[model samples]
Target: MTRFLARRTAMLVATMLVASFAIYGALYVSPGSPLSALTGNRPLPPEAKAQLEARYHLNEPFLVRYWHWLVSALHGDLGESIPLHENVSTLIGQRVGVTAGLVLLTSVIIVIAGVGLGILGALGKGLVDNGVLLASTVSAALPSFAAAVVLQFVVAVKLGWLPALGTGHGFADSLRHLLLPALALAATSVALVTRVTRAAVREETGREHVQTAVSRGLPWPSVVRRHVLRNAAIPITTVVGITIASLIALSAVVETAFGLNGLGAYLVQAAQNKDVAVVQGISLVLVLAFVLTNMLVDIAYAVLDPRLTLGGRAA
Candidate 1:
């Protein structure tokens, strides 16, 4: 276990490094120089441009800048936000909790709704199963933004059941504001998890072990709980992990739609302003999150099924 964890940690570090480089390179390669965004309509003098470049180390080679940025980032210095003129770390610190809360709540909802529906569908062979499958299919086909808009209109705007914009103050208030956006963000994940779970459990239900349990005169529910769901846990766990990881990216759309000042909203603004520092910082953070989540999922596999070995042949 120790060796496996060490190896996976090394891989995570490498993955994060590669992701950071890709984010930095992609930004540099995109249209419009960072300088252009800074200057806006006003044309800067040659000296002014040179000064700005030197200050931000933009005049240095890409490798040199990236290395410097990486080192600084490792030391918890994410540099300054070009547009906001705030420390990148400080900016993220303020808003990350809100985003984390939103994602956490959404993930809970996904696991409950998706896994519950999937299990119910798997156990029922007729209308219940078909209804769950149909719902999952329709949800899977629906675009996230369209779902967000519809929810925003029907739940927030028309019914006035919840706040349509901005994260409210305090825990209770925040929950009220975050509920709709979290649901919208979780729609696709719920559908994906539901489908994955239902399929996995259904496959397990027909296995010889399940039949043996039934032949032993075990109740259907007992058979399902002890045999079917246990055997299906691996794939279901994988889908749940993927769903949670994707929520970080999806928060961009949901946050924007709801006017939440989270990392996603900050990312969108940074991209629009061509704020390279903020963009790079936030992108790296998200990448690290994604990598960490996957690593946790890998670790979870061994926990979910002890017979399965990590980084070696299964037991």
Candidate 2:
């Protein structure tokens, strides 16, 4: 376990370093000059241009600038947003809660609806199973942006069930405001989870032990609980973790569509305005979240099946 964790931790660090470097270098490699963003493509006096470049260490070697940024980031300093002129860390801190809340709400909906529907489909026959398949297929085909528009128009704009814009004040209001966005964001993920769960559960049900349990007259529910679902958990968990990790990136589209003031929305705006610091900071944070979530999923594998070792070998 120790060795496995150490290896995973090392990989996580290396992945983050690589991701951060890529994010930082992206602007340099892009079509326009980094200075063009600062100057809005307008030529500045030599002294002014030199000062701006110096301020951002654009005059330094890429490696030196990256090292400085990386070192400061390690100490929780993510630099200042070039356009917004605010500290990147502070800006992210301010908006992270909204995105977190949206993702949390979406995750809840995904787990409950996805897993329940999957179980039903796996255990049911004929129409029930077909219905689940239909639903999953339809959802899988629906993109987030399309879902967002439909939900906004039908649920928020037309039906008046929820507010269409902004992260509302307070817990109850926030949930109300976030519901549509969450649903939209979760639609495809829920479909993915449902399909994966159904497949995994069905596969588990066909295993020798499960068949033996069924032949021995164990209760269907008992067999499902103790054998099928338990055995199916690892794959279900992997899908769920991937879905959850992806929410950070996917939230940008949903948040923009819904006009919510979250990190995703902020990231879009920063990208539009060419705020390199904010873009790099938020991208790194998203990558970190993805890595950490996958790590947790790996840990969950060990918990879900004790016979499996942390190194992914059978004990």
Candidate 3:
């Protein structure tokens, strides 16, 4: 376990480094000059331009500037947003909670609805199983943005059940505001989890050991808990982790449609305004989150099935 964790930690550090470099390098490769964002695309005097260039290290090589930025970022200074003129870290800190809340709520919905429906489909007969299949199929075909628009119109605009815009103040209000967006974000993910879970559970039930246990007249629930779900946990866990990680990226569309103030919405605005610092900071944060979630999933693999080592080898 110690060796596995050490290896994973080392890989995490290396992945972060590469992500940071790619994010920062995007500024140089992307259309438009970084100075244009600072100057608002207006012409500047030669002397002023030189001063600005020196201040931002525009005169330095890419590697030198990246090194400087990396060093400062290591100290939690992500530099200032070119458009907003506020600290990048400060902006991200302020908005991150909304996105986190949306993702968390969506994850809960996915796990419960997805896994429950999957179990029902695997165990049920005739109409019940058919209904689960139809629901999952339809959900899998719906995109987050389309779901967002429909929910925003029906649930918020017309029905007036939930607030249509903004991240409401306080915990209770925040959850209420985020609920619709979370549902939209989770639509496809729930379908994915359901399908994977159904497949895994069905496959496990067909195993000779599972059949033997069932034939021995053990309680059905006990048989399922011990023999079916336990063996099916790995694939289900993998899909859930992937779905949750993807929510960070998909949150942008839902946030925009619902007019929520979150990192995803902020990222969109920053990208539009060519705010490279804000974009880089947000990208790095999201990348870190994705890698960390995958790491947790790997750890879960070992926990769920003791026969599997932390190194991912079957013992």
Candidate 4:
């Protein structure tokens, strides 16, 4: 177990380092100069252009600049934001809290609604099962942006129950502001989870152990709780783990629509302003988050099924 954990930890670090390097390279080669954002349509003098290039190290070779950025990043210095003129790390630290809140709340809602509906629907086929299927299909068809617009209109604009946009003050206020966007962000994921869970549960129910439990005269509830759900959890866990990336993508649209000052919003803003430092820093953080979430899910697999080793050996 110690060896397994150490190996996973090493892989995590290496993966994050590679992801960071790729992000920096991508941003370096991306079209549109920060100078365009700086000077706009105004023509710049040769000296001014040279000064800008020198300041940003644009005059350096790609590999040289990349190495410098990577070294500084390893030392915990993400550098200054070109557009915002603030430390990139500081900006990310401030905004990541908001994105975390949104993701957490949305994840909770998705797990409960999706897993609950899936389990209940799988217990026996009837109207409930059909309804769950229909709902999941419909929800999955709606894009995040469209869902956010509809939610904002219904819950905030028309009903006037919640704030339509902006991050309000305090925890309670922030939750209210996040609800609409989070719901929109969670919709597709909930559908995905529901489908994955339902399929897993249904498959587990038909396994030989489930039949054996029934033949032993075990109660239906016990059979489901001890046999079906336990075995079904593996696939469901995979789906939930993989959904983190989708959630990140949706959060960008949701944040834009709701005007929340989260990491997603900051990324969009940075891209528009061609803020390379902010973009690279935020992208690296997001990739690390994705990697960490999958690592946790791998640990979760062992908890869910002790007989299955995370290192691929059967316990």
Candidate 5:
């Protein structure tokens, strides 16, 4: 178990390195210089341009600039934001929690609604299952942002059931505002969870252990509860873990639609304004969060299923 975990950890490190390199390289090569963005179409004097370039190390060789940025970023220095003139760290810190809260709420919805539906659909396996499968398919097809618009219009504007936007305030009022947006954000994720859980449950139901338990005169509910659901959840658990990691930079469009001030919103604003320092800091933090979340998810596998750890079985 320890060896397997160690090996997976090594692989994860390699993956992160490759991903970071790609992210950094792409950021550097992306068109439109921050200088141009800062100064706009008006041409700056040579001396002014030189000073600006020197301040941000734009005068350095590309590799040198990248390496310097990497090192400085490691020490919590993301250079100066040409536009905002504020510390990148502070800007990102101010916004990250909002996104974290949204993700948390979305995860709860996905787990509860998704898994609950999976269990129900799996137990019935006919009209109920088919209907859920169709709905899940639709949810999966729609992007979060588009879904947010649809939900906002139908639920908030048309139905007048919930508030249309914003976060923070009276718990009930804020929650009402959050409901549609969170559902929109979570819809695809819930679809994923439902599909995974349903497939797992379906497969587990046909396993020899399940048949044997059934043949022993156990109630179907008892058999499913005791034997199938836990084993079935293993694969779903993996995807759910991955989904959480994937949320760090996701939900920007949702934020825009619903007027939520989140990390995703800040990222879009930073990129649009060419706030280089803020962009770099936010990107680095997002990548690190994903890497750390993935690591935690991997560690959680062994905890969830004994078969994958401590010599129970090779997976």
Candidate 6:
């Protein structure tokens, strides 16, 4: 277990280094430098531009810029936002909690309801199965933005059950306003988890162990509990981890549609404004989220089956 954890830690560090460096390269490769944009359209004189360049280290080599950004990043400083004229880290921090909450709540809903539906669908190959399959297919086919819009119209506008604008308050109020957006982000994820779980569980039930349990008259439910569901959870856990990672960026449309001021929405805004610092900051956050989610999935493998290793070392 210790060896496994060490390997995973090494892999995680390598992934972060690669992701951050790539983001640094992209930011530099873009045309019309951030410094130029930060300056006004009045066309500052050569001397003035030079002063600005020297002050901001715009004249530094690409390597210098990369190293500077990386060092600052290590200290939790993501630099300043050109458009907002504020610390990018500060701006991102303001929205991180909201986004994290939305992501977590959405994940919970997807696992519990979606996986439950999937298990039910898999247990019987009749109308319930067909219905669940159809629903999953439709949800999967729909683009995330379209799903948000449709939900906005039917649930938010038509029924008026959910608020179109987000509310900041106690947990109850926040959840009430977050319902629509969370549902939109979760719809496709739920479908994927449900479909995958159902198939995995059904397949597990047909295995030799499950058949033997049935032959021993261990009661159908007991057989499912011991031999089928237990094995099925492994795959379902994997899918859920992926779902959580995807959810980090998937909430953008829902955030915009519902006016929930979250990281996804902030990222879109930064992109539109061409605020590279803010955009990269948000991107780094998402990458971190992806990495953490994967680590959690790895840990869960050990939780669900002790036979699994922590870092994929010898069990």
Stronger candidate by lDDT (4 vs 5): 4
Model 1 lDDT tens row, 1-315: 877688789999999888988998888788877777667858889999899989888899989988998899999989887667789999899989879999999999999999999998988889999999999988787666888898989998899998888899999999999998898888888899998899999899999999999999999889988889988989999989988998998899889988899999889998888888889889999988888999999888877776666437422
Tens digit per residue, CA lDDT, model 2, 1-315: 776678789889999999999998886676665667667899899999889889878899988999999999999999997777789999999999999999999999999999999999998999999999999999999999999999999999899999999888899999999999999999999899999999999999999999899999999999999999989998999899989999989999999999999999888898888788888999999999899998988878777877667446622
lDDT of 5 at 69: 73
TM per candidate: 0.94, 0.95, 0.96, 0.94, 0.88, 0.94
Q: lDDT tens digits, residues 107-133, model 4?
A: 888899889888977875789899999
**Residue ranges of candidate 6 with Cα displaced over 4 Å:** 40-42, 310-315
Worst 10 residues of 1 by lDDT: 306-315
Q: Which has the higher TM-score value, candidate number 2 or candidate number 6?
A: 2
Per-candidate Cα lDDT values, in order, are 0.88, 0.90, 0.89, 0.87, 0.80, 0.85
**80-116: candidate 5 lDDT, tens digit per residue:** 7778777777777778867777777887898898888
Clashes of each: 0, 0, 0, 0, 0, 1
Task: Provide the RMSD of all predictions against the true structure, rounded to 1 decimal.
Answer: 1.9, 1.8, 1.6, 1.9, 2.7, 2.0
Q: Which scores better on lDDT, 1 or 3?
A: 3
TM-score of 1: 0.94
Native-to-model Cα distance after best TM-score fit, residue 72 in candidate 1, in Å: 0.6
Error of 4 at 191 (Å): 0.8
What lDDT does model 6 reach?
Answer: 0.85
User: How many steric clashes does model 3 contain?
Assistant: 0
**Model 2 global lDDT (CA atoms, 0 to 1):** 0.90
Off by over 4 Å in 1: 310-315
Q: Rate residue 313 of model 3 by lDDT.
A: 78
> Which of the predicted structures, 2 or 3, would earn the higher TM-score when compared with the native?
3
lDDT of 2 at 7: 73
TM-score top scorer: 3
Off by over 4 Å in 2: 310-315
lDDT of 3: 0.89
